[model samples]
Structure formats: structure tokens, C-alpha cells
Target: EKMPLTPNGKLDRKALPAPEGALQTGTEYAAPCTVTEAKLVQLWQEVLGLERVGIHDNFFEIGGHSLRAMTLVSRVNKEMSVSLPLRNVFFYPTVEEMAQAISELERLEYAVIPQAEARDYYPVSS
Candidate 1:
């Protein structure tokens, strides 16, 4: 007897397709490094109508196209205040990875301020 191979001509059953551990059993998601990733996943689920979306899920595999990606980016910009370069999203497709990258970007590019309505300069009284 011979073993079976997948349609792609690779070892099928021997490959072990699913995750080894209980990665997604809980109600709460693992906290993402940046707000952008958390919101991105939420938006993606709403746009795609998915029951539950894992951070590692592939966008293209879930029927995402360039136009949808553009819409997603627009939402991200409006909501997260992060102007993601179009290419960067494709490069870092996963939520966790993208979050780490965005967190790095925030640390490097965006200056953190304690107050939202902080004046640009101290008020001058004459």
C-alpha cells in the first residue's frame, strides 16, 4: 500500500494541518500590541461576515480583494489614526504581527501625549 498525497502533490495526512495546542478556545482574544490590530480584526469580521476570525487567518484566503483592502485601510486610518502604507498590510498580514509593527511605528513616529486637548504652546497672557 502507498500513502496518499494532497492535490498539490505533497504529503497530506503526515503534514498535520491544524494547530497543535488550544489556541482559540477562550472568549477573550490575546491582547494585541496596538489598538489598530484589535480594531482591524473586528472590522474584518464585520466586512467578511465571519463567525470568528483568527489573527493568523489569510485575507486572500477569506476572499479579500484589493478594493476591500483599500476600504479596510481607509477605516483603519479613520479609526486608528495610523496611515498604513498599502504595501505594509500585505507584508504583515497577520493581526499580531501587524500590531507589533504598528506598535513599533507608534513608538518611533508618533509622540505620546498625556492630554488629548493639550495646547500646542503654553497660553500667553499679557
Candidate 2:
């Protein structure tokens, strides 16, 4: 079993065949419930070249690996504006869990500084 290679001695990814139909994994198929989850499912399907991906399906179990995980993270960062760690993919291997992690990373957690505290700042340029 060998991957198709281009004339340049590189892997011919386009020549790779896609998985047939929906991928079967250990967990039962569950459609994404939230927008984030739906986005993750779409990304996974695109990255893995599958027809359907469930929110509960494990990324690795469904034909994902480190390389595909990187591609997924790159797509998520580009499309969702959320930075995801590669290791986190292993930690949150399911679409639902990865979506939750992405949501947490995208969440804005900030504390408003007191108005009076602003007065203590000295203008360095002025």
C-alpha cells in the first residue's frame, strides 16, 4: 500500500482517493448542535475527505492524523479566527469537544479597569 506520488517525488495528494460515504467510528453518529460544532464538523469532513462527519466521531478514528490535524487547525484559524494548538487536537479529539475548546479560546475574558486608575498613567510622549 503506497500513496500516489507526483513526478517531482512528492506525495500526490490530489491523486489520493477519498473515503466512501460516511465514515464509521466507535461512537454513534451525532450531528453538530451549535454553529461552532457545525463548523468543526465541516472542517473535519473537508480535511479528511469524507462525505459526513459526526460531532462525536473521533478525529483519529475516522482517518485523521497529525498532518490532517494541522490542516484542520490551519483551516479553523483562517475561517474562524481562532488559534488552536496541535496537541489540543489529541486532547479534544471529537468535533464537539474541539468546538468547545475553540469556543473557550475565542471567548473574551477581560476585566474592565477602574476609571480612576486611568488617571495614574503618565504620558511618556507628551
TM-score of each: 0.53, 0.66
Q: Write the per-residue lDDT of candidate 1 for residues 42-96, one digit (tens) a residue.
A: 8777766765666766665665778877877666665676767777669876667
What's the lDDT for candidate 2? Answer: 0.84
Worst 10 residues of 2 by lDDT: 107-116
Which regions of candidate 2 fall more than 4 Å away from where they truly are?
1-22, 107-126
Clashing pairs in 2: none
Lowest lDDT block of 10, candidate 1: 22-31
Best-fitting candidate, measured by lDDT? 2
Which residue pairs in model 1 clash with each other? none
| Among all candidates shown, the one with the greatest TM-score | 2
- Please write out the lDDT profile of model 2 over residues 1-126, one tens digit for every residue: 899999999999999998676555768888899999988888888999988898888889988999998998778877887768889999999988898889888633333456654565766783
